[model samples]
Target: MRVFIVHAHHEPTSFNHAMTSEAVAVLTGAGHEVMVSDLYAMGFDPVSDRRNFVTVTDSEKLNQQSEEAYASAHQGYAPDLQAEMDKLAWCDILIFQFPIWWLGFPAILKGWVDRVFAVGRAYGGGRWFDSGVFAGKRAMCSMTVGGPAPVYTDSGVYGSIGSILHPIHRGIFGFTGFTVIEPFVVYDPKRLGDEERLACLARYSERLLVLDSAPTIENPNTADYEGFVLKSVQDKHRGLD
Candidate 1:
């Protein structure tokens, strides 16, 4: 598989960095082509604005989607953004590796998505959900969390981690047409012993080797919906609604 990892951690020595590094090594050793965008190391800009494009669709007013559509047709993305877009297009599998901040992805990674996943390029013109631009590709999040698993459970303070990540899984990955793999979460890595960390890394390596066959989160099929709602109770029961 052609894998692209977008890593978003400021500290080089952090566990998030270690996961990305390990993935590259493991995937490459197994004969997979790999590319990494180390956002922090690259000094990536997280803010989105006119800086995202080389051409202006409307200088009088800033309309992001309008500019993105124009840029998509003309190849007018700023060099940095275009580079990231190219990598995104080239990869069969996309991975976002970072530390979960608060209840979501790091600001840098979120910004990367804002600037990189643009209209016409990533999604637009009725191309979304299962019919999205990246429909055939796969995406997964690999994150290190500050809290333990128990704390993120249904009865815990944070509620279900699945619910917490619904926006990322359903809204971002699924909506963009990528098959969503269940996230790889490392809980409270700072409190883990060296042996435990090694074990976690080994598990991550195992997951990568079987990525092609990994179980994925279910996404709603456009056919199952009537406009935006489910066509029937049966479809909803099947989780497609």
Candidate 2:
């Protein structure tokens, strides 16, 4: 399987970096083709500008042919968007490795989504909101957090980690039509000893190797959601009547 690993951690010696490396090793050793996009290392521009809105025109060619060719060739094609799009298109599985900053993905990763997941590429005018270019693909988040697991659990201070990550799981990956597997989170990195860290790393490595073996959740699209909304509305009206 072609795997695309997008690493968003800034620190070279951080636990997130180590996990990214371990994932790469495991995937590569399993004979899967892996591509790493280190956002910070690559100096990825996260800004989405007006230049992306300008349409490419070839007036010299016939109108229909030019438009068709341009639309076909340039579907979700832009200078800033091409690199990540190419990588996304090339991969069957996408693993996002990062540190959970402020209970979410790092700014760079968020920016990556903002810039790369643009109109005509990730979403568009005529395209269905939930049906993006990445449908049928699989995604997983391998994240490291500073807080303990207990803090993120139900009835804890931070609430459930799964609930905290619902927006990312439902809004981003599920909305874009990728089958999102359960995230693998490592908590309380600062509290771990060297030996414990090593054990954790080994376990993480094993998870990466057999990621496909885990069952994926069903990704509901806009159509599915619309039906639910319509049913709810009908039920409300019937109750009133």
Q: Which candidate wins on TM-score?
A: 1
TM-score of each: 0.93, 0.82
- Tens digits of per-residue lDDT for model 1, 46-157: 9999999999979999999999999999989999999999999999999989888989888999999999999988888877778888998999989899998999999999
In model 1, pairs of residues that clash are none
Cα RMSD of all models vs. native, in order, equals 4.5, 5.7
Clashing pairs for model 2 are none
- C-alpha lDDT score of every prediction, in listed order: 0.91, 0.76
Q: Which segments of candidate 2 are over 4 A away from where they belong?
A: 51-76, 124-132, 228-241
Report the C-alpha lDDT of model 2 over 9-81, residue by residue, as the tens digit: 8889999888888888888898999999999999887665433333456545434333433544556245555
Clashes of 1: 0
Provide the lDDT at 169 for model 2.
Answer: 79
Q: How accurate is candidate 2 locally (lDDT)?
A: 0.76
* Steric clash count of candidate 2: 0
